[model samples]
Target: MSSTPPPLPPHALDRLRAAVRLREAGDAESARSELLALSGTYPRDPGLAYQTAWAHDVLGREAAAVPFYETALAGADALGAEDRHGVYLGLGSTYRVLGRYAEAVATLEAGLAAHPGDGALTVFLAMARHNTGAHHEAMSALLTLLADTSGDPGVRAFRKAIAFYAEDLDRVETGD
Candidate 1:
């Protein structure tokens, strides 16, 4: 029952769309640079901050992206429901990449609580749990995802990811 967020001004939307295109083209640095340049005009725009953080995340600058993600989230009310919920996944993933498993778990768990049906959040939570040696819980979540043989590509991808992690766990357990 979330209402749609108000539309961005034409100029802002155009810039954001161009930034997205840059990202899709695998030019994260360009996208980040563009977004940063647009920051002054759309200073408090959550979408701009999110794109900036997303670009940094894609460039593997977890430390650099963290603050921007936090900034975007701090002004989350400025975003639509979709963006508000999606930011957690990126932030949680950045935390995981930084080896901050506790923070990752906390961020992902909170997101999962808010969006109970988000498979992405569930998978991330499982990943964080696995990193923390909560192998059983991780396996439980993977198994649940694996049960969804619905032929949806996204579900298939999640299953494959779960399998990859499960294999790692098995190898570790077997000392191989």
Candidate 2:
């Protein structure tokens, strides 16, 4: 028996694409409706679950999105890398906005462990840390990300200094 999951039926794929298009066209409500309907028919589809969660998120329904995101992530082996990454970010960010800071930190940390050096994930992780009162870690993460990714010439010039300070923001240096 083939270990690979069977490909989605053509009609299902078309419906999924149409739902995504609705979302992109600024009709998130319609998208959510379509995705929810499709999810009823394709209850085990990881991709569908992910899209349903995204639609809920775009509609400012973070709590409603959590179970769908969890379902998608639980079936991670069936999802593409990009979808997996989105699940982690979406779930983590949703948790943060919902005041579930510890869950956000755990989710984002797990994502970073799996997809290291991702700027978006790092940024969200920093936000989660800040919410959890890990101010030092949050600032350090933001500073490091800024130093590594900022395009401003001035920032580039001071990258080394920023990195050094990121390691120890409260450091005091005295000339002897």
Candidate 3:
């Protein structure tokens, strides 16, 4: 037999980290149960609440995530600026994934006004615009973002994504 390893069952911390991983690699159902249990223990912990919301989000449980995220945001009112930004980002992402494009745009725009150099928010706004058929504006925003000096990985990805969108739009219009 080959020397390949079998996958291990996820523990609480692994489940927690995987829950927030970008590609949805976690035991979200287990994460929800653990977080719900922890919520009773740490009822006032914004960090725990935020993780719970993120777990719900990754599990495609948008309705379940919203109130938890809102609670985290409210609890973060006295925290650092970065923490507050994170809250809006989570809310904006949840709304976007739920097809609430208008709310995504509005929330992300408000976050952008507060944190002007946020490439992540810019990409998110572009995605909302693209989903809402505002492709031209999306392309413009991505192109504008490409010109920024302090280039982040997300900005680079945004540029590439926008280029792809532009090509797709061309194909649609030209019937190619």
Candidate 4:
């Protein structure tokens, strides 16, 4: 008797892609439904777990998002650098939503320290600082990031927002 290997599941990858599409389209409900289904099929699929966590975050269910984000981070840690960066970003964003500003700042800062000069993590750290009322510090970080030629466009735009916040902080600080 010859042993035969099992064939890959048809359309599984496609379904995962569709779930990611739904996530990008801002359809958190649909994204969660599809990603949850995918997770059920592949319990060890970190991407699906990450996306599901993101969907929960988009739906304002921050509490529900934390554990999934943690799982994704753990899985990504052992997988690949890019995947690990993504999970760190997702976890930082989720912590920000949960009003866990300190954790968000720490997490994003750790990611930036690991991947130095990473504009995305810089932006996230700035946001975390801003959320925690560290406006001056946030603005300083944003300015540093914006001055870097390699900084991301999205982060540059966020720098502008932080500048505005910084201006407001200045006014308040000066009693103007």
Candidate 5:
């Protein structure tokens, strides 16, 4: 038997695409239901798992999305390039929203390790840190990100650094 699997049916792909569009349009409940209906057929399709979780997350239902995100990560090979890392981001951010800041930190850190220099990971990591009341640590992490990204050609990092610093200055000035 061949090791390769056949391509997904066009109809199934279309359904997935439609679900994504529904989620983007803020009809996340419909999107989640649509994808949940397809889970048994595409058990290993990471995109399905990710999209299902995304709808839940977008609807502010983080707890429901957590397992789906974990499932998607457990079998991520079926995902596209952007989705492979995007799922990690979604999972980490969900954890943060749920007040599970430590899991958020670890998840985002793992994402950074897997996809080094990803700006999304850096930003989410900073957010997770801040949520955990580690403001200094968050700033340190962002500064490291700024240093790493600024060295790359044509990528602006100093602007972000300035923005963060400016926010801090304003907060301190207002005694917040």
Candidate 6:
């Protein structure tokens, strides 16, 4: 049996593109409706599920987006790498906004495991950590991320110190 999912039908692809265009044109409700209609026809399509979740998120319906995001992730093997990454980010962010910090952390951690060195996942993980009262760990992550990725001259000059402090924010240097 072929492990790969079948390619989406041409008509479905065209419709999906149209729905995306509607979203880009600021018609999120129409895009969501179109995506929902398409989903009824291709309920197992990861791309469709992801797009549907995105539409709900854009409309500030985080709770509504959860199941669609879960559906997309459940069939993640059918999604392209970028889409899979996006599903992780979106679902994790949605959970965080909904006050489900633990789920957010777990989802983002899983995403990082799959896509290591992803700045976005690391950043969201930090937020989730903060919400879960892991303040020191959250600060450490943010500081490390800033130190590693910053290009500002001032930040660049202090990168080494920032990295050192990130490992132990509470450690104080004693004058010998």
Please name the candidate that would achieve the greatest TM-score relative to the true structure: 6
Writing each residue's lDDT as its tens digit, candidate 4 over 1-176 gives 42222222668768877888987887879988887877777665566667778888888888887887776765664536786787788899779978999999988987887788888888888999999998888887766656454356786767656556545545555465
Best by lDDT: 6
| Per-residue lDDT value at 22 in model 4 | 86
Model 1 residue runs over 4 Å out of place are 1-10, 40-43, 149-176
Quantify all predictions' global Cα lDDT against the true fold: 0.81, 0.93, 0.71, 0.76, 0.81, 0.94
Q: How close is candidate 1 to the true structure, as a TM-score?
A: 0.74
Candidate 6 lDDT tens digits, 82-139:
9999999999999999999999999999999989989999999999999999999999
lDDT of 1: 0.81
Per-residue error for 112 in candidate 6, Å, reads 0.7
Candidate 4, after superposition: displacement of residue 141 in Å?
Answer: 1.1
Ranked by lDDT, the better of candidates 5 and 6 is: 6
Candidates sorted on lDDT, descending: 6, 2, 5, 1, 4, 3
Candidate 2 lDDT (Cα, whole model)? 0.93
Q: What is the C-alpha RMSD, rounded to one decimal, of candidate 4?
A: 7.8
lDDT tens per residue, model 5, 68-125: 8988887676677789798889999899988899999999998988898888888999
What does the lDDT read for residue 55 in candidate 6? 97
lDDT of 4 at 9: 65
Clashing pairs in 5: none
* lDDT digits (tens) for residues 1-176 of candidate 3: 52222222355446445545533555677778877776666555566677788778777898788887877766765446876687778888888888998888887788788788788888888888888888877777766666553367776657655556554544454465
- Write down the TM-score for model 2: 0.93
User: Distance from true position, residue 7, model 2, in Å?
Assistant: 4.4
